[model samples]
Target: MHSFKRVLVTGADGFIGSHLTETLVRAGYNVRAFVYYNSFNSWGWLDQSPEEIKRELDVFAGDIRDPHGVRSAMQGCDAVLHLASLIAIPYSYHSPDTYVDTNIKGTLNVLQAAKELGVAKIVHTSTSEVYGTAQYVPIDERHPLQGQSPYSASKIGADQMALAFYRSFGLPVGIIRPFNTYGPRQSARAVIPTIITQLAQGNRKIKLGAIHPTRDFNYVEDTVEGFISFLESSRSIGEEINIGSNFEISIGDTARLIARLMNVELEIETDEIRLRPEKSEVERLWADNRKARELLNWQPAYGGEKGFEAGLAKTIEWFSNPDNLLNYKANLYNI
Candidate 1:
């Protein structure tokens, strides 16, 4: 595997980004973490990382939407991992233009800068939601794209833009489409965090939307590994690789597994407010992962049951502490 000496990671303040930043650092690569700029000088989750990990990362605060700032961040970096974007589907309902600006336009900016920087590889982040309500089980890279939600639409645009760069300008870009990654430090907006946080606060009953929909969840670490593997593979260039477990479980069953892990028999309640527009709901997402395995030689280390057990243990432990749980708005559903 060819390891880049310096790697730039956009959105390093986020859950998956932070984990990937730390992993890159551990691999002896100098890490430049591009986090959203704030007056507070807060480096998102990087600030919360252990001192060992924090010291290994040089956090650069900037907006991915700005081409100048993105180019500056890419300077001296051998590769780039672009994970910054607006991802909350519910919030996308209220404001979608911002999603387009950040997700689609921001991706264009990254591709342009990477082209100028002569970066070895550009690992672009995509989401499973882009294959909305999968027309077929075990959705592969060739699966049809759907835009049921504005968030998914924006991501689809971004993914298309990334591929366009590769085809038009020969940019060494690979799209890592992760399926429902969940773990510690995840925002409460995600279903896993929403469920785990509710249970952590001693709630016996949980409110959720469209529990019947199934997703293939990959633990954050495994997803990160997929990102790294893609970067190290020559075949991944211009390829859209899926990083997911070849398994599926309904959100209802997922909640049950979490409850079992927590040893709580919580009743699941559906909230109308939480449901998506009648037809917009994505009913099922199962990943084939054959391309990922063939190209990157990566497979999920944790499957559904074990991943749930491990994730719930870590997430519950984090949420149990007031410092973490206090960050959530438990009373209202976060879109």
Candidate 2:
């Protein structure tokens, strides 16, 4: 494992980023958390983190789209885990401009800053959505990218920009493309959280769209572990790796599984507003994780069918808590 004095985590206040930050601090790494600046001075999910983890973090509030701020955030850090981006697919449909600014330009700022700063390693986040509808089962890193939505399109642009930096400037950048990650603190916009929050709120009739679409779901902790694996392995440099559970299940089946786990009789109702434009829907996704296993020696603790159920149980337990459930508006459509 390569050692670094300080590692910067962009989007540190977010779901996966918060989990990764806490894990790194617990593992005894010097971490600088770069959170988005807001008028309320909110640190997002970090505000809910354990006191010990909060105390260990050195928080830097800045915008990823600002090159100056990004450079300043990376000043003393040897490596960076860039996870800042606008990721809601539905919101992207409403505002494609914001997605372009946040996803594409935000990544460009990180790339330019990392190149100039001589950062030792950079791990950029990518999504499986870029592989629209998965032309084949078990998508590997070599799969062709198809941007079916504005959100996925922006991410595709960002991923290409990261790769271009690696090729043109020889920047030590690695991309960690994670499949659907769900667990505690995930936004309601995602299908899993939407399903869980609705059921936990005593709604037997769950609302969703495009239930036929299959996804390769990875638990949040597993995704966090993938980030750390990529961060430490010198072999990950210049490589694009997938972090996924290597299992496939349709949204409808996933909802039924959650209902069984929660001991609730489920009735799924299609929410028209939640449906993506016909061609924009990614019908299927299953991961081939052999590359991550061989290159980074990484494997999802939550892998395969049984592992998915176990992960869902853990997620349900968390969302079942009244305090957590109160944060979501289960009665309304998330997007």
Candidate 3:
């Protein structure tokens, strides 16, 4: 673990990646942030990070699809957290080709670069979506892979690619499969943000998708800690670890929880425009995090009730500010 002096995080500008990068920098590791190359020169959520934290980052603006750029970014980095991908399930339905290129090919670029650069460790991010609905109570690492949507299919392919590098090329890699992670800086495309933002906007009616489906929500900070824990623990080298809270709640219940926390009585009308195709809905997901507990020595510090409180509080505060809500489309339904 001590062999790594510098860590590189791909997708460092997104929600979870930004949080993990901040945590890594605070942990005294020299951090490199691999954000997407955009003409706007924006850092996404990293732009919203405290100036103190932003000062420590080595920002590299480049696209993950470019092999040259990926390899160059890994040159001096000892470890890499590959989180770059197009992850919206609804958007994937409309643009699956984009998902394949960004999620699958983008991952290949990172894995190959890590192998060529001899990076000590590569933590490839996976999603619980790959498991689809849980066939059993708690979906373990052995759960059969299911592609309920194009986004999940791309992730499954990406996971397989990273594992192949570990087996065929002896590249040190591990897959960190996090379930539904929600917190501050998350976009309105997600359910938590949608509900909070709608309520914060003073709308009595909250627009939402299939509220019947269940999810095991883990706060972003806990998810980031699990990623750090994986780097320090040798047992996770070739493992597929699930970073989850081991608790489940339906979307309808979740909306109610948020409303309760915010002291708002609102109707959760099922917005047909927000719903996915009937077959594409993932029925349920609750993770068996015993592997994460035993191997990473990690268990979620925030449960559903507590996580909801903190997340909703922060989300409400963020959305209450019109400047922030200006970026969100509160009038429309987001899948």
Candidate 4:
């Protein structure tokens, strides 16, 4: 394990980013949080984090697309966890140009900065979306990448760029590709939150996109721990590893499960507008997490039937709160 204590976490105000920041701070690392700057000075999810965690973060607001901004934020940090990017698939379809600029160019800026700063380690974030509809049941690192959408294409470009830097410049970087992660503070743009928010708002008919598509859902904490494990493992350098529950569940069944946990009977209403173009929708995804287990000595604490049910129950409770529920517009389709 590398002994660096100060690490920079870009996209620190986001769902997974916020959870990872809290875990890093509690683990005694000096954290520098790079949040997207806005006129409202909104810190997103971090604003809701406990005060103790907030105090430990040296928060910097900047745009990752701009090389100068990313470089400035990364200065003085020994390592970086780059998670800033445009992630929504629907949004990406509407804005492919922005996706390329942010996901690809933004990653280049981080890699260049890390190389110049002489950072010992870097943990770049990737997504399961890059795999498209899984070619195999348990998608391994070697599984062929299919860019089914503009979003996945951009991520594929970004992941390749990171690997190039490692091969060309000998940069010590690791890519952590996480499957669908769900929990408190997840944006309503995600399927889990979309279902939970609608059901919590007392909607009997839940509107969703393709319900038959399956996903491997991991809890936020487990994904965060995977990031830390990758950072600590020397063998992870220059490698790409998956962090997931390795369990697949259809979207339809997941919605029904959430309804049961919420003590409500609901009808799954498929909205045409919510559906992706036939070819663009990824029909299924399941992960082979053995790489992370063997390389990082990490195993998912929240996985399998029992862990998934427990995680969903906790997520349901969070969305059940009026305060959190109000943040979501359950009546309208979010992206």
Task: For each candidate, give its TM-score against the true structure.
Answer: 0.96, 0.99, 0.96, 0.98
Model 1 ranges off by over 4 Å: none
Candidate 1: C-alpha lDDT: 0.89
lDDT of 4 by residue, 52-86 (tens): 99987899999999999999998899989999999
Which regions of candidate 4 are displaced past 4 Å? Answer: none
Candidates ranked, most accurate by lDDT first: 2, 4, 1, 3
Model 1 poorest ten-residue lDDT run: 303-312
For model 1, residues 162-224, the per-residue Cα lDDT tens digits are 999999999999899999998888998889888988988888889999898999988888999
lDDT for 7 (candidate 1) = 86
Which residue pairs does candidate 3 place in steric collision? none
- Choose 2 or 3, whichever is better by lDDT: 2
| Candidate 2 structure quality by residue, lDDT tens digits, 58-87 | 999999988899999999899999999999
C-alpha displacement of 195 in model 2, angstroms? Answer: 0.7
Q: Candidate 2: misplaced stretches above 4 Å?
A: none
Q: What CA root-mean-square deviation does each model show from the true structure?
A: 1.4, 0.9, 1.5, 1.0
- Candidate 1: clashing pairs of residues: none
